[model samples]
Target: MVIPPPVRPPRITEFLKPYVLKMHFTNKYVHAQVIHSPTPTVTASVSSQEKALRSSMGITRDVAAVAKIGKILGERLLIKDIPAVTVFLKRDQKYHGKIKAVIDSMIKAGVKLL
Candidate 1:
């Protein structure tokens, strides 16, 4: 009997491209990070839970808070010389509500989303 070859898992670089923009939302905070796929390293990150952000935000988790996190993340990425990224939304999160708010703020902050 002939046997089929085993399938290999796809490389993160194969689909994640050069860099990935990751976002996560919890009941109490929103977080975002820019990762370099090849090196598998986080280049920049921001969260509503950060002490400075929290002090400025008052409300830790909300669309506004998420937007602030996104804007800050985008700025950090820019500072790190990452101008573009592929957005990776965690789990079953949809492109609405806080997610949309974050993405919009990122775009406004001048980070190109692929």
Candidate 2:
């Protein structure tokens, strides 16, 4: 018999920080948000599934679509006065492919990634 390894949760510090950016990607869509930790509120959120964004791209699962969502998210964050953030990537996620595209687009949109 094989025993499954234990699962470790994300650090509490991630939720205690001032501004943290969390991203989620699935087979059909990508979503991102800037969360205010102290208040535990989402300051801004963007997803490829949004009507405006989906209508513009016509596809929600590609890397380009993820980049577009990131751009929009960054713009929204800037509008809300959040200029920089610490990224919180899930343990199963890597900083490549679609994730890289999103982060690059956010930087291009003027949001600093800490």
Candidate that would win on lDDT: 2
TM-score of each: 0.82, 0.83
What's model 2's overall lDDT?
0.86
lDDT of 2 by residue, 1-114 (tens): 999999999877665668888898788888898888877888899987777777789779898888888888888988888889888988888999998988999999998977
Q: Ten consecutive residues with minimal summed lDDT in candidate 1?
A: 11-20
> All models: lDDT?
0.83, 0.86
Q: Count the backbone clashes (under 3 Å) in each candidate.
A: 0, 0
Off by over 4 Å in 2: 1-16
How far off is residue 102 in model 2, in Å?
0.9
CA error at residue 8 for candidate 1, angstroms: 16
